[model samples]
Target: MAANYDYEEAPGSYDDVNRQDLGYDPNFVPDSVKSFVVHLYRHIREKNVYEIHQMYENSFQTLSDRLFKDTPWPSVDAVSHYVDNDQVFCLLYREM
Candidate 1:
């Protein structure tokens, strides 16, 4: 979960789904997630990652701290087009 993200369950909560499809991998465990956050924060601070200005203006989302609590982890679909895929839909609500 990204610290900057608000964890309230709301209409835009699913926005991360779009980011995941765009290229963000959202399945990292807590350790990896923390490491990623630190790395990204550093990258942002150092302006090492390209197009920082563009990324700064874009909308992004991430999961909440409570996202994994008591939750059965779901697998990413083996073959799914994010634009149009039933598997994505299945994965989204399979555990719920």
Candidate 2:
């Protein structure tokens, strides 16, 4: 089953190291495994939306600093959702 979540742009330009470095598939993951990640991701986005105006605001200095350590931060448009096999993943995409 697919699920939809409301999300805003993440505060910085960081990518998910778990997905990137590990070459893991969001689909086919276990619910218990992904639940914590989803929760943390949402918590960060919620906090950022409550603080930042522009994607550049990067108002959450700690999160912003770590995330955009070496890259330019992008602007996010909306939250995206997907389900593969029995696993589900959601993300915030920056608008080009």
All candidates' TM-scores? 0.24, 0.23
Candidate 1: clashing residue pairs, number: 0
- Expressed as tens digits, the lDDT of each residue in 10-62 for candidate 2 is 32223445333545333323232233234445545467544233332432233
Q: Candidate 2 has what TM-score?
A: 0.23
Model 2, 66: alpha-carbon shift in Å?
Answer: 0.9
Q: Considering summed lDDT, which 10 consecutive residues are worst modelled in model 1?
A: 53-62
Model 2, residue 41: distance off in Å is: 15
Candidate 2 least-lDDT 10 residues = 77-86
Clashing pairs in 1: none
lDDT of 1 by residue, 1-96 (tens): 223332223433344444344443445333323333334344555766453332233211223333343333323342223213454334533432
Error of 2 at 85 (Å): 30
